[model samples]
Target: MPTYKQFPLADTAEGLTEADILSWHVKPGDTVAVNQIVVEIETAKAAVELPIPWAGVVTELHVEPGQTVEVGTPILTIDVDPDGAAAPAPAATPAPASSAPAEEEEMKPLVGYGSKAVVTQRRARKGAAPAPAPAAAVAAPPAPAPAPAAPRGGYVPLAKPPVRKLAKDLGVDLHALTGTADGGVITREDVERAANGTPVAAPTVDSGTRERRVPIKGVRKMTAAAMVQSAYTAPHVTEFLTIDVTPMMEFREKLKKSREFAGIKVTPLTFAAKAVCLAAKRTPDINAVWDEEAQEIVYKDYVHLGIAAATPRGLIVPKIRDADSMSLKELAESLTQLTETARAGKTTPADMANGTFTISNIGVFGIDTGTPIINPGESAILALGSIRDTPWVVDGELRVRKVMQLSLSFDHRVIDGQQGSEFLADVGALLADPAMAMTY
Candidate 1:
């Protein structure tokens, strides 16, 4: 019998149960190396590429692009090698007997470290193995290795690992496709062309809805569950405060050309974020979370400030670590970096963890204000509103200027009405007169 090894999915990050397989990298009969990107899966926060643990000729593709797989379900199979003739085979675990139902089976890697590590196989690093056999010939697998991508032309292009895999799975030549955007780089559309039978239109989706529903697998499934859980568990208290932000508007204009805010987008939210951090500092209780398991309150010393962004998959809050220590310019740059990462689905798991406070800048989407929900584990969140011209009284005279609203949502259990109002007032005061922020 030709022995075969199955490569099951594993939890890529904490609290993650399943991921949506956005795309696959290799097809049946194709040679793959250890650490080679086998698939791209969309998690709640970003799209991440997962590498194959073992090197081998792909004997079967168990899931198609867009299928969601559980954390330990086998998505594909590879032929294992021994004696350096083929790729190292993943260690095998005896299957649970037939009486075990699909849901009852452990949908995870076997828990033991040595004898139970599912998919313990490793592969040869790039350039370490001898050249593969000719395209038409049966080739020996690469040598033993751990998984790891070379940096391309000064920039790692933003495609997910699965996008690269999609090209491979569809037999589409990735290098042949031309980038429609800057520097002529190829995109997902380029590889998708081969999958649809006709050449793909660059940067565009297939005309009309020959709709495809990718099974919600990895991150998407985990994220949806988390959002639903948070929505139900938290007792949300939302309070809105609108202010004449004309002064803040003027402050932003002055900062844009100033050296202190050099090379940064001096938006009201940047100032709002700084204000929130300062306010949280003054109100320690609101900055803390209820650790239900430990039966203790956890107060974070450093702020992992989360910025909520809506991506194609869903809402992802990628945090900016130690945001309190950064200058206005630094915060602006970080915002830009996180936004791009969120859009590309490349923000790592580390980027999404440890958020002590969250800011949902709905202003960018041109909304005035909204009663926002508190992110689970965090006690408070602020919604930054849109700036628009409105008539307001200043020094007993009415004048038209940029005005905006701010909404602060806090956990009522930890934060009283007085404290929540004070925090909101502090954020409003800073925006109304940003020069006042120097005191903190």
Candidate 2:
């Protein structure tokens, strides 16, 4: 007999109401030892990989990838009784595993673990319309294109199905293409090349006064709620400081060649991230957040620096847990992972929960500086502005320098101007000479 135990999602931290499982590292019936990574979950605070607490076979995958579950929700069931079997019973009639689609086997982490391949089992039938028409009730342009006036040469006709699909994906005007295949059919070569490389400037799509609307739900709904809560509850005060980030820029360039940063996207923001972590260490109060109902402040020893990233979904601040202890290489890797996970819309509510401070890099979008609002539950947020070549005096001589601005926003209730300025100054000093970050 196999004994079963269900694992509930722990409160990765206080007030983390929910989280999304980004991927299941182990699937049902797979054996996992204690401390083995079982799943990667996105919380409001950060993306963290959960370790299985017991050594046992993964009997059931309770939560699907991309499914949002409240804290304490059972995610996986592990069978771990001393006398029980480690593996689950096999299916009655199993199909050959080799038959599985090649695409699914070579999976990328899409939403959660890779999705199962959708098989439309069929075969070619000559003299049949290339594809069943999109149900008659469905509306669309009649011919889809105004077919080329005449056929090009005697290249074998590659059915209309391939031609139409190619046209749709490439946004090509099939009607305008001079077909290279026999009977005026398009070839796969032409379409594949066009789709693979940099997208050709597509012909303007005519909207014809059509209004497109997207419903406010899911991530968007959650973001709106969080923003409303943060904007109204936190008393925001933003301060700006412009600095000549020459040293930081030079340091970044040097680090690029270092082995630690070879795979990471070394940028000005990475230095800003280090600056935030170091400044927080010097003045712990700047990193402290206010406690609302208790009317006291909660000071944190470890800094979880949140990087405010703009994704296709909305604004999400995924934190780098224990930023104070991370080396520059580790920090770069964490930031890289955060941005990639955010764009994939895999950021969970839990990952955004316990951020102590945040850095919003408006610099990526070419903005000089702006007063950024506070991320709720956090005491402060620092914004890094664009790094651009500007006229400056170097050694009392006029020279062009790469300069960037910083904006620090703090909650007035928990942080005062003196404390905020000191924190900002410390951060500026580090950026002005990042090698000094190690001391603070």
Candidate 3:
């Protein structure tokens, strides 16, 4: 007899309740091997690829792409014994509406499985017929007009719940509009185009492009929530310092040719990170967390430095583990690898956890400076501004020098104004003269 196996959504990270099915690599009837990646899912924290535990032939897919599935729900089924002898047929019987306890008991938890039973109900199919009424019930009122006919080849459109809601709100019939997505799945953009009476194939400006609305989910949704929590929960105090970083800029040029830093692509941000690490040693309280529930301040001994990187999805901060312990060459190499992994959308949840302090390099985008909100757990954040050539008074002589601005935002409940100002000044001083970092 063939053994049927169901693959449940495992806990990819802590506090992950659900994940969106981004795409499928294997379909029904496809032969798969153990540990082969079969699907990709996007959770609130990161995008992860799931591997099948047992080698088998895919029997059925229980979930569709773009659908959010709760943890522990069966997303796909497979037959482990494809060549096994067929079992004797049973007498004619009606299948139960819900799975039996025997079937549930047969489910073996794979490695990393988070839960045992499914928690979410699958959505009902669009235009499904109502269940038959009891004989004693009165005749139901006449059914409403049937939905607009499906597209060619009698294909009904596939759309997510939000897109369906948008179509209904705009008085547009989804079945009538041709979809531009893969496998005739309707998207929000398709519905908006239909509402504007434009051809779904070609969306042009002539169709009155007033505004475009994007649904927030995944990374964008998580980022929004974190920002709101950080802004409201913590009292923030921002202090700015303008400094001439001419010495630091010159030091970077010399370091580029040194054999110790030969392969590293050194930049101003690299020097800024080094300076922060060195300054953090002098001001250890700056690298701390506010423990609200515990009613105490938690000062960290080491730094898991968070370098904020903006991706196509949203802002993600992947940390460099034990950054204070690494040399400048090691820091530069780790920073390069961490950022490349983050931008490529491969940063894992663990890579983002346990950050002691953060740095937001807004200078990359030509931004001068802004009061950056603190990362959720961390108490302080440093923002680096654009480097420009400006006239400065050096020893009472006006000369052109490389100048940059630094802004530090700290949780006022944990750090006083004096402490925050002193921390910012130390960072500015180190950056203004790279050799000053050694004195600390």
Candidate 4:
């Protein structure tokens, strides 16, 4: 008997309810082994690859790419006993007892459930026969040509998952364009060019309908909900401070050429991160969370610092766990890795949870400071503005100095105006003078 198994979408993270199918690695009639990656899905936090637990021939894919599915919903089906009794008469013959262990090993349980036993011996196809002799060789009639293979009407374009997703998002037809990459693979630039060349037919001089609509789902939907909740629930208080950071900028340049900080990214954000961690020691309220159900303020000793990153999917904040304990070099490396991972859409839900404080580096966009909403579960958020040279008074005379702005937004319910001001001032002071960290 052929045993058919359905693979459901499991919760990849805690409290995960649903996900969108990003892509499928296998198609119907493809053979797959246990622990083989068969599909990729995008949850609220990150994109995750799912392995099929059964070693079998794929029978069907239940969902298409970009389709959203709830947890426990079947996404694929496989026939674990593809060479079993359902095949030709010879396939029904029982295998020798000695081969049982091999079957068991091939069908080993994964995650929790065990699939059907694997059949090692492949049965011959029905009606298969030896070829006849050629007319020139044996003076007999030539063998008829083999039947043509079934037409593969569904031609999948050669592109990476990210490129495919980008094409889909831009409404670009991948099949219409020629790939310029090696092996004729599609690249991100190819998709963008195609999108740019596409004609827009909806907009006209007479028609008032010119807006495009996109369904809010996945990370974008989750971020929107979080921002709304945090904005309405937490009474936000924002404070701004502009400071001359020439000393810190000079220190950064010196460290970059030094042996201790070689190959490390010691940017203004890195300084801001270290400042926030050190400042939190004196003003712990900046790292605390409000417990609405318990009616108490929860304070944390360790810092899980979150750096706000803007990615193609959406804005995500991945945390550096226990950041306060790390030295300057360690913090720089951690920040570099965190930003890269978040931008690549690989930041897991666990990395985004339990954050103590957040730093939004809006300065990267070349903009000055703006009031930023605090991330959910965190007490305060800081926005770092662009650094530029400005005239500043030193002792008695004016001189050109690197100046930047810092904006801090805090939950007034848990953090008073004084605590917020002190925290912001401490961070600004550290940036204004790197040696101030030694005093902390």
The lDDT values for all models are: 0.69, 0.69, 0.79, 0.79
Total backbone clashes of candidate 4, pairs 3 or more residues apart or in separate chains: 0
Cα lDDT for residue 136, model 2?
Answer: 29
Alpha-carbon runs more than 4 Å astray in model 4: 85-209
Better of 1 and 3 by TM-score: 3
Candidate 4 achieves a global lDDT of: 0.79
C-alpha-based local distance difference test score of model 2: 0.69
lDDT of 4 at 368: 88
Highest TM-score scorer: 3
Per-residue lDDT of model 2, residues 1-440, tens digit only: 44555565666643556777778998867888877988887655446677765787776675656556666555676666546454533334333443432111111122332232211111212353333333421232222122234444532233344345566777865444444443334556656655565343333446795754443434566667777888899888889898888888888888879886777897777778887888887788888888888988999999888888888656777888998898878888888888888887667655776788888999899999998888777888888989999999989999999888999988888888999999999999999888786686
Q: Model 4: which ten-residue window has the lowest total lDDT?
A: 139-148
Q: What's every prediction's RMSD, in angstroms?
A: 13.0, 16.5, 8.2, 13.1
Question: Which scores better on TM-score, 2 or 4?
Answer: 4
Positional deviation of residue 29's Cα in model 3 after best superposition, in angstroms: 2.2
Off by over 4 Å in 2: 1-211
lDDT of 1 by residue, 286-310 (tens): 7889887888888777788999988
Q: Which candidate number has the best lDDT?
A: 3
TM-score of predicted structure 4: 0.74
- Model 1 segments beyond 4 Å from truth? 1-4, 43-46, 80-116, 119-224
